[model samples]
Target chain A: MKEKPVLRVTSKLLIPPIMLFALYVQFHGDFGPGGGFQAGVIFASAFILYALIFGVDVARRIVPAWVSRAGLSIGVLLYAGTGVAALFGGGNFLDYSVLAHDALHGQHLGINVIEFGVGTTVAAAMVTIFFTFASQSPHDPEDLRDEDDDADFDDDFDDDLDDLIASRTMSQGLSQAGGAGGREAR
Target chain B: MELAVVIGMLFFMAAIALAIIWVRNLFAVTMLMGIYSLTAAALYVALDAVDVAFTEAAVGAGISTVLMLATLSLTKAEEKPFRSIQHPVSLAVVLVTGGVLIYGTLDMPAYGDPDAPIHQHVAPRYVQDSGQEVGPPNIVTSILASYRGYDTMGEVTVIFTAAAGVLMLIGRGRSGPGRRRKTWDYEDLEGDER
Candidate 1:
């Protein structure tokens, strides 16, 4: 998948717009068919695409596992802290009315910030899931055994042949089927 | 026209389900699941639940398929052939549950019924007053964020907890080329006895 020039060029070109769309979905959620959950997933998907095209290590350097880990909590704290802030301002728990001078302004501020929190957590969760699942340490024999245990070995070797053909057909667009080096099959 | 599209989508969904069940190849199954999600999202759009459609498209179609593929890469792509016959007890349970669900649907109000139990609730107030009460023109956002801010906050917390759980279980935090993996390393080199 990484070898093809067309794929690399197009994916590099495509990454920004996808990210921009995700942002649009994040902020324009109130007015259109978009929201934090959707935006977050879209954002993660764009990163995943970048990882797919560029490399996991490259993408990791950009996003950083630590940053996402911080995001996981920071997003939640932001949302919860907003509520506590409102409560301290002489309103009930999560009551946005007292957060600002007026109710309308408070609602606007509250929704945007809370939605941002949701977006952050969701995006971080998604990327974390991808990183954990996709990047397996290849040299580990014990981890290999874990996979072997889960996978029931087919007695017939021809099944592998069939699987090969099936995979070839399935991975038509993804032309780098054979001789794929260092990277796992996505 | 809406009814026709709904019917078509449902048929496609049923066919996709059957194909998914029939396909022993996990990779093919994952692709079918993506198609299923896309179909479901389209159906949501037809129903005018654009927010739901968006979520379905992003979460179900986009993220879920990628996750499944990732899992498949980690594990095996071929499912073991079924050696056992269908269990009568399980079949009986499924039948009973399906029958009960269908029977329950009989007592349910028609779709888009204005006087439905849900519509009778404070949804009306949210719909009517959201524009004035909350500055947001989108009532759903107003209700989700402003009106039920605590619930939204809780939802964010749940997502955060999920991320934390994943991190605790399998997060490879700050792993470089030489860095050893974390708890989710899947590398039980010690072969610690269970």
Candidate 2:
């Protein structure tokens, strides 16, 4: 994976355009077929591509899992909050007509706000999900553990392919495997 | 000519579906499923469901394929052969569901009929007045975000709920934190290892 120069360069070039398209899809939903859900997925995918290229550790540092968890909650709050805002403005729950001075203006403003909330939640959730799945086994040991103990652990590795008992520690194996490549110098 | 093109595309989609069913390789199936969604997106375009086409192409064809490939990397590349006897219950369930679906279609009006219940009912009003009422150039947006605001909220909630469920199931923190300390600095890690 680290050896593919063509993929690395192409993906590096594609990430920004992908993110920009996601933004366009997010804001242009009102005038086109796109909306929060599609835009959110699109946005998350750009980061997913980045993670695939640069490895999960760098991606996690950029957009931590805790932030994503917060985003998931915040997006829901924003949508529900918009409804409450409309209600407090003398309309029923989610009645955007009363959200502003004029009904049309209120509708426009409310929809935009809610869509933003939707986009935020979706992008965060998708990215978090990808992180959780991708970071499950191979990448965690490298970043989350001490390299000293990791090296000591790897030194005890049995070269016998038939010894399944020696393969108990997946983290130990992955660290040795990845570090042995030595090409992914970031 | 348009009808011929549509028919050809439909045939291609059918072939892909049959291929998906026939192929034993999970990786090939994943690729076929991507093709399946792309074709579905094309069908949406043929039907002039541009918004749906966009979603079908982006989410259905693009993101889902990547996600599936990611999932595949976590597990075996080939599906195991069936170890259990085929169940009559599954066949019964499928037949019953198909029969019910076909029955439901009996009451559906002809495709694009002007006097269809859907066209005759609230849709005409939506088409005629949505521009003035919702004040958006896109009637679809007006209907989804304003006219059907509650429904859209519910859709967003569904995504949130699904993501929440998945996070709860497979999320981080299961590996027993506090078991190890972080050693992120490269120079410090090299010193420690030495």
Candidate 3:
């Protein structure tokens, strides 16, 4: 993935806008055509693109395993905690009307808070799943022995084909299929 | 006009599906699946489900494609050749199920029918007063975050659970002595591993 000036420059130009759009979707979801789930996925996708172009290791350093894990737990807690707060606010479980002095204001606050919680968890979950998959041992040689009879030939061909397809389709970020390079880069 | 657009999009989706089925390369299949998801997202827009469209575009087209590509790296790029495509029993079962599904829809209300049973339910209240009640102009957001808050919370929890499951299965953090070495010399690591 290294030594690709075009890809690196393109990613640098595009990533900020993508992140901004994700935030727009996250916040404007209240008045428009997006919400937590969409925004979260969008947010993670920018990082995924970054990972693909640079390397998985770089992406991991930016949003480490612990950070994503914290997001996963904290998001759920924020949501559930909101409900618990409502219980203490002299309302039933999950009720939002009593959170503020007025019902409408309370609803606004509750909805925004919960939506943020949802976004956080979703984004974290996606990043975690991707990182886990990305970081796995590329192959268990024994598993390939039976299924891929021409293992040596097929492996090389698959790597080239993967690179070809990735470059052609994505138009940037080459060399994801080289697990050897990926591991060594780490 | 909207109906025509929907039908055209549906045809595109069907074509993509067929292409996916015909393609043996896993990479092409993944790409086709992304296209199919994009078409579906467009269909959602035509049907006025913008939220769903956004979700489909981001999650279905974007995330799923990337994940599938990552998985492809871990496995084979080409699908194994199948022995036979003519499975009469399976075909019969699919035809029967699809027929039943279409038959079921025949009993439902027409598109945008105002007198539908759903329109008569609590939907009226949500549609009419949700702006004032929830304070969001987008009724979908209002319902999702306020009226149906529990369901959304459950969905968030489900996502969290999925993350937890993935973490337990594979995200054990960077462990093992080999990974910990972390030298910048690619050749050294390569030689050692080989």
Which scores greater on lDDT, model 1 or model 3? 3
Model 3, A30-113: lDDT tens digits are 889888888888888888888877666556769977899999988899999999999999998879999999999999888888
Candidate 3: CAPRI quality band: medium
Point out the worst 10-residue segment of candidate 1 chain B by lDDT.
B185-194
- C-alpha lDDT (0 to 100) for residue A108 of candidate 2: 87
Which model is ahead, 1 or 3, in terms of TM-score? 3
Interface RMS deviation of candidate 3 = 3.8
Score every model by TM-score. 0.83, 0.80, 0.86
Full-model lDDT for every candidate: 0.72, 0.72, 0.78
Clashing pairs in 1: B170-B184
Candidate 1 runs further than 4 Å off: A138-186, B173-194
Worst 10 residues of 2 chain B by lDDT: B177-186
Categorize the docking of model 1. acceptable
User: What does candidate 2's lDDT look like per residue over A64-115, in tens digits?
Assistant: 8778888888988899899999889999988888988898898889988888
What is candidate 3's local distance difference test score? 0.78
Q: For candidate 2, write residues B40-113 as lDDT tens digits.
A: 99988888888788888887887777677566444444566777668999989999999999999999887657
**Cand. 1 TM to true fold:** 0.83
